[model samples]
Structure formats: structure tokens, C-alpha cells
Target: RVVGAAKDLPPEGKNYSKRYDSGEDVDRVLELNAGTVERDNINIGDNVVVENL
Candidate 1:
């Protein structure tokens, strides 16, 4: 989950935008917040390509 702009994330999820504003390391923050199983699907530091519809 990605939290920010009215989006929802898990309890441990830090506000993505807030993190950005604070210049926190995003991938590391995400990894830290994710559960063990979630980490399997989403590897921090991996390249992610987004497609706009």
C-alpha cells in the first residue's frame, strides 16, 4: 500500500509524501514497513516501471 493523497497504507506505513518531503530513503522505508510476505512480492531497491493508461 502507498499512503498519501488520500490513499491507504498499513499501520507501519509512513506517509510517502511526508517521507519525500523529509528526504527519507523511500525504498528502505517501504521495506521496513512491509510484512515478511509482502516483502516477497515487493523487493525494495528493485526498479519499478509505471505505465499510464
Candidate 2:
């Protein structure tokens, strides 16, 4: 289940997404390498939640 979707994320950094639906700036938001996730993949347009590491 998707928690939420944001056009922008916190912590400025590069973020990668399979889809480019989201116009989030690449300079901001930690980006995950393409294909880094498998089984269940999360794309740019997909909503997600960040938990405490």
C-alpha cells in the first residue's frame, strides 16, 4: 500500500526513478539506482514512506 506521494522530498540529493512522471529535482532527494529494488519495484510516480534506518 502507498502511504503518500510528494512532488518533492527532503534532504537535497540525487534521486533516480524508473518513471519520470514526478518532476522532482534530481539535485534533491536521495536517489536509488535503477533496478536497485526487485521483487516489488518502486518507480518515480509511486508513493512511498521513509522509515527510520
Candidate 3:
């Protein structure tokens, strides 16, 4: 699990209409492209960390 702050998010609007006011929770999962896994023996359960900028 992870906790952080954002300058924009959904439920406020499809676009960032309430970005200037405050942000909200945005929890979701992302799928990695098949080509990104360049390992021969990649496991099914692997831990990955991604940073958004």
C-alpha cells in the first residue's frame, strides 16, 4: 500500500478542474507492456515500484 498527495485527480472532473483547490485519492493498478519484461525467468509474483512525476 502507498499514500501520497496530488495536485489533481478524478471525481472532481474528467479534467483537472479542481486542481487549484485540492486533490483526492486515485488508487489504481497499471499493466506493464509485454516488451518491458526482458527477462527469461520472470516470476508471476514480482514486486515493482513506480514513481509519478
TM-scores for all candidates: the values are 0.27, 0.30, 0.28
Give me the runs in candidate 1 sitting further than 4 Å from their true place.
1-40
Report the lDDT tens digits of candidate 3 across residue range 1-53.
Answer: 22322322335455655423114354554434444544433343554567983
Candidate with the larger TM-score of 2 and 3: 2
The local lDDT score (0 to 100) that residue 20 gets in candidate 1 is 35
Show where candidate 2 strays beyond 4 Å. Answer: 1-28, 38-40
Cand. 1 TM to true fold: 0.27
**What count of clashes does model 3 give?**
0
Overall lDDT per candidate, in order of appearance:
0.38, 0.47, 0.41
The full ranking of all candidates by TM-score, starting with the best, is: 2, 3, 1
- How big is the positional error of residue 22 in model 2, measured in Å on the Cα after superposition? 6.9
Q: Clashes in model 3: which pairs?
A: none
| Tens digit of per-residue lDDT, candidate 1, span 1-53 | 33312124445466554433323333433233336435455443445444672
- By TM-score, is 1 or 3 better? 3
* Candidates 1 and 2 compared by lDDT, better number: 2
Residue 36 C-alpha lDDT in model 3: 51
TM-score of 2: 0.30
